[model samples]
Target: MSNLDSQTAYWDTAATTKTFTHPLHAPWLDDVNRHAAILDYGCGYGRTMEALAQQGFDNLSGVDTSPGMITQARALHPTMRFAVLDTPPTLARPDASILFAVLTCIPSNHAQKRLIAELSRVLKPGGTLYLSDLLIQDDERNRDRYARFAEHHDAYGVFETGDGAVCRHHPSDWFPSLLADFENIDTRRITVATMNGHESAGIQILARRPSQAQVGPVDSFTAGLEDR
Candidate 1:
């Protein structure tokens, strides 16, 4: 099976037995508006969405690639919106229609690029984008792991675990560069404690899409020439 297929199957099996939602989501929770639409992308088992709903955010929705998770989410939260996205997403929302998270679970840079582009297109100017994922560290252990797995890997920093599962990590500089179109509000590295008690390196970021009216230096220069 392809990596995507493998991941989907893994998550489907995991849906009934695991809860992988990160515990430290305060960065995105601080400015949440009850009236605005929020999407929990890669929302597994709808745990995060359920938490948000309990906090009084009514206009919330979620999408996941695993049907098993979607099924569990729908069963648990019958009133909330959840969709199973098995293909390239064709979200019908207008620009700036939502605030969302690009959380963990993606296994490759190509997948990350496509998702970021789609989010950028649908995110309204001034909308918030929250991202949290594994960070590439300069540790000898990580380097050794990469060296051993790079030949058979699906993407950079991605490798097959001994258990035959794919995992990916990214460099610290990756997100800020990937999100140059957005105004970064905050970024911090934190140690994530997994359910199994193993700690992992991770980073969280909060960024805002610049309003359409905000012009760059090039735009300002062109506009000045036009007025002359």
Candidate 2:
């Protein structure tokens, strides 16, 4: 997409309106380190980056595929680094990253896997990855509804959307296996009431890369926990 169109879709007023409706802002802010190098993956309009700055994080950077979005972010946060990323990113190997509502926009499972691998690569040992995205539920009705939404959207590589909302859905069980290369720290579901008065469900996952000291042969129980 051209820079202008991308900005319209991701950095416009509507996008800002949609973002604040979610609960990710406060929690993510609480979790990020103020002094560590941080990346706002899929940072639309740089809102989260701004929020991070407000929290006293100076070593912040943002990456988005849309040049328009990047432009808006750079203009708004002049001191912060903003870059256009078409594929796998190669910015600073950060101590942490905030990936709020980003993975769901990836079109396929393979793409998700690739992105996770890239995240692992870009993070330092013992670094943290915080991710939030729409999640598949065990309820048959919810599962059916989610599947229909995915089908209707024709979501297929870098971008996906449904019913005027762009997103991809993943099961709650997906993260453990997908992030097995990292040490699983925690996982939970969060229910958000959107501004339009609709309730949506998503998963919040926090994981850390194994520290250098913890990389040796694992105990049986620890190894089993790794599978959990």
Task: Report the number of the highest-lDDT candidate.
Answer: 1
- For 1-228, candidate 2 gives per-residue lDDT tens digits of 232223334434443344433334355446555677777767766776676677787876677765666676677678878777664533343334567666655545665676676666656666777776766545565456566655554532122233344445565667788888887777677885532454667677777767662432211111000000
- Clash list (residue pairs), candidate 2: 104-168, 161-166
The TM-scores, one per candidate, come to: 0.79, 0.69
lDDT of each: 0.59, 0.56
The alpha-carbon deviation from the true structure for residue 25 of candidate 1, after best TM-score superposition, in angstroms, is 3.3
Off by over 4 Å in 2: 1-33, 89-96, 137-166, 193-197, 213-228
lDDT of 1 at 137: 51
Residue-by-residue lDDT tens digits, candidate 1, 40-131: 66666777666666767677667666798889888888888888766644444321222222323556666666666666666666677666
Q: Model 1 off-target regions past 4 Å?
A: 1-6, 92-104, 137-143, 154-156, 195-197, 213-228
